[model samples]
Target chain A: MNWMRTEMERPGQREQFQDALLRGDRPAVEEMIRQELADYPYWRDELLGELTEQYLEGAVPFSQLTVLAEAAAALAEHLPPVAVCGSLEGNPGDTGRNFIQMLFRAWGVPTLDLGADVPADHFLDAVSGQGIRFVIAAAFSADDAGAAMLLHQKAMERGIRDQFDLLICGAKLTEETGKKLQLACMDHRAAAVARWVVQTWKNR
Target chain B: MEKQMIFPANRFALVPDRDEVFAWLQCDAGPCRAAFEREWVPALQLLEETMTPVAVCAQRNANALTVFLTIGKETEKRVSALFQEERYILGSLLNTLCDEMLFQMDSKLANILQRELVSEHLYMAERLEPRVHLSPETLQADFGSLQSMVPFARVTTSGVLYPAKSMLYRIVLTGESRTVSALHDCARCDQADCLYRNRKHESLREKEKLPERELKESTKRRKRLVWREEIGIPVLLSSNASVDDNSEVSRFMDYFKLADPNDAAYGALSDRVHLLTC
Candidate 1:
């Protein structure tokens, strides 16, 4: 439990913010930001810098970006399907699943939540049995790429690899690896996913 | 079934309080305190000067220090063996440090940036956009004085506290690196039929200390030879060489297979090992 805390922002705060974001409570984020800003006047710039870092580094994608504006607008809405995975790189506390949920909501897709370290069989059962349209494999290292690869293999074995659009996103995914596997590798950018989904859907 | 074998002196329980333990070992009272103090300070100083490996450890878990100490069996055996007279003082001192409050340790946040979350930058870039407006100055001012803290506690698990019976203790250190590089080579090796051939760490030379000629012959023959327990596991070198099935080391590796070594199920492997290793 203690190790869990080291992996991310304080769990309580993170959870609250996540809840607010999911509820589409833009005002809450704005208000919380304002209060935090007031609490640490000196850290306002740094906090924003950190937030920007999160955004640019793809922790908070464009779809999730809407949460910022929506917070400003004071609207709260629920999001779509999500999946969290442990790091392939051995780094702890990645929140790509939550970010993806936010992005899927922006695309008007209802995302299911399947948490981290989930096995390949579980993923297979979920996708085929649960009618999952979008599959996002998130990892933080090259070793984690195996999880995504397993999914690819499973989908192909089940003859559904081409049926549903699949995307692999993470810090661990390499250009060569993605090209080798023919996976649609994206960083944390929701817009990139959005673009790909739109194009794939149109082509379909 | 067996009256869980207890050691002669509950050497582990001597210093119940973790903080007192750390003070004795790192500062004064430990069995190897003097030597460690003399060597450690200098090593730390040198490490700081070069900054080759990031000192990513945090104060959160005083236990992590002890856990790190036990990472290598040879290191543990050497330290544990020096447990008498002034050595006892040093050992006790070390034990004291092991008992200290992990949260009290200093967290090198810079090291976290450099080592622990090495690819955080890449994660940010892939998920978020490149340029964004930030009231950077205010945020810096906010967090400037707030010290970076580590949250994990390094408590000794049930299994790790037992006193040693054998001269050497078994230490299991696995990583994603080995499975990716070495296991792949193992799969490709001609000796795929060997039972213990599938799992090996990268770099046979590093694992196996053999001359070039023996190494070549070993590679060609694919003879899975077992080493005696005297030297620990019989290490086969050369990318991912097969382990002799009859070796004690192979037996030891087999005992741990309640969980798979490669792509363990549901990350449960890490959690189980954490509990067992402390």
Candidate 2:
């Protein structure tokens, strides 16, 4: 029913939108996204994807990053809640996990933001204690990887691994690491992860 | 707990340059720039009206120098009273600005040391090794000796060195040339939350002169500087090794005199002893 969604549905428009974001066309991106939001309030995944790409490319400043995240969170108000956590130790500056949370919120997915330096037990408590079904865990440093492994080990110890879906992301998180931990490795692309979350929720 | 000695305030003098402090405020002005600008004038006026600069004496031991410092008592009282009355955000801003001014005063003191004593390096263990270096208890224990140095500042019964905005630091004098050993290695330190480490990493990356694509690709695997644990000079003590429970107990006992349980002060002394030991 939304014209902007219909326009975005046109072939290559999504790519153009992504290109605009990549080129750092803030005004154009803001105007188009705001217009799109007026009718297709749930059209957050695509925008999140573009923003994520820009962030990964090192085009977004920290202040602008927060603004983008807040915008995404605003759109995500109608979605079911999820839980996301950054590394227990500080993430390397390159890690975009915080932005990924913004992308999650943009997809109308309510998120419990367990901030950086979270302990393993805290992550487990958020899952089993709060009855959260899906978790997005991110790590950026060697210490962060250790913390993530500890979280997984604790979850396994408590026999609650089967109770929730754990999705891992970050530069340090490889496919081998994901396999070792028995968790899905969400690709670095925020839009792809956002879409996956939407599809998974629909299937559920 | 070694006994502390406090020298008279006449032994040292600290004069803060308003311009240098303003320059530092501007340099550190990032996200807080607007707030800093809005508060700077009023804060400066308040400081001019209420503040008194005071320096505590220093002790020189061969190659080491220990200096204690604090902004005078009246200013601390005024600031605390203001903080209690003001909104949380504004109070925090004022507090930070005052701390910055005090830090500027400390910098001036360091400069004076360099000029008078021919010392080139000044080090605060807190700033250098935030996680593992000198603990507050050790500083407080050492501050006992220097407590009488500043008449206005007091060491709380719990061994907290007060005039909350205070600094205790050591100086390094290298004759003829100023060459400090590069001891901080970000990759080696367990303090992942340190902003200094993050800034160093960013600076190192900038110095690499790599193209964007190459920089991105190489950042993950780039070799990191590792800290060497060897000490070049015997003068600098290992900050990590300086403080222990046994020493803390000895110091606390010396400060409070907790020798006999049957003494009239036994109950209060026992409570303090328990708190210190625990």
Candidate 3:
């Protein structure tokens, strides 16, 4: 229980963990998290963190977002009072964006969805004088992906970037690009975003 | 070999109800109204051009009967292409048209099946719809009888029909006569508050214990659930919906529709609402 020794993390266990997460089997995730009390941090980071990385890289299929959102919903109580989310303007079929909002909704997280193809300024205005903790922007098109970065850039230029967490998401986002732009980038999936949000909240 | 009957390209097109389709799209008026006004006729025309509505009916072992109806894969693709192109209103209208078509097709087929069964002196005593009356095991075990006709559709391991728009039904035939439309499979459920029974949130909002006038919007009443049939999306409303409590003829979108009546997305809908029920 005191950060002792356990069997090494293996590809077999990793696959099983991912299958459980993607299937929204929280009990299995909880079981694996508590599999062995030994080296608790190692197990949590390796299993969950690595899974988030896989999700960010677009290794996970787009259709699995709901189950993945369900997996992340356990962290609901840890969520902020309210947040704003939307797909960048003019992107048709806001399925991914809706699913992500639904992810927040699953935990009864109060989200002001600006609807698909939102102008970045609407986001800025929604949080003004409001208790918003973060902004989750989804981009379904290559153009909207640029809009996400643009939103981050505008938030920074206005010196309002520090006001709330700005999470830009697209399949195109990468750790390399995020670091290069110095923007808080998110994976296309909300599950990982939720996890990142919780981690960021804890760190804050 | 199981004998199969496939109705291909029959002049059996059922024109969808315009108001119902508009209601499903949440676009009875306003910004979408103009779009819907401009596009519905053309959209219906396009749907008719693209959809290959088909029905398959088979008389199974003894007197068992089964029927599957679909507007075909290409019709679904056409609707998907519209959504993909971001013609949200038109695409949604056409999308709901497909469902209305399937629904009309189901009723028509059911009647046809009824007539056939009656002539053979067999009564359609009991009927089962896939998700409604049939259990997962029953759907999986029973789908084999109809699968060969639908090359693209199959019951999943968990028993959801692929190409979700496709409809499946099985009608039980018996020697004894029974009323054609009897209380259905819902009688079997034990859960008191099923969404299926309570989908009429508009009505329930009236029957809500506390009148809307007494409840302060900021008091934050416990959230209630409402569903729009065939809208292809979910609506999770914000709790700030205490103003303009026009529950009658209010679309699901009206609950959280922005306050400014001039807002592009939902402006006309909220403003045009009257006391009449649609």
Global CA lDDT computed for model 3: 0.55
Cα lDDT of model 2 by residue, A112-176, tens digit: 76654467787788887777777776654333455567777889999998877777655345456
What would the per-residue lDDT of candidate 3 be over residues A140-203, giving only the tens digit for each residue? 4233445666676777777787788777654445455566446564565566666666566546
> Which has the higher TM-score value, candidate number 1 or candidate number 2?
2
- What digit string (tens of lDDT, one per residue) describes model 3 on residues B1-278? 55577777664658778865555444454323554566678788888788877778777654566777777767666665654343444555666687767766776776766666678788875565543345445666666777787777766543445454666667666788766542233322222222223322323344576555454342233122112321224445342332334553243433333222233343343342110000
The lDDT leader among the candidates is: 3
Top candidate on TM-score is: 3
The list of candidate 1 runs beyond 4 A from truth reads A1-94, A188-191, A198-204, B1-278
True contacts kept of each: 0.00, 0.00, 0.00
lDDT of 1 at B112: 27
All candidates: TM-score: 0.32, 0.41, 0.42
Indicate whether candidate 2 or candidate 3 has the larger DockQ: 2
Better of 1 and 3 by lDDT: 3
Best by DockQ: 2
Candidate 1 lDDT over A39-115, as tens digits, reads: 22113223323444565664542323433323322211243343222222222222444444444433334455465
- Give the DockQ of candidate 2: 0.02
Over 4 Å off, model 3: A1-204, B1-3, B29-31, B182-278
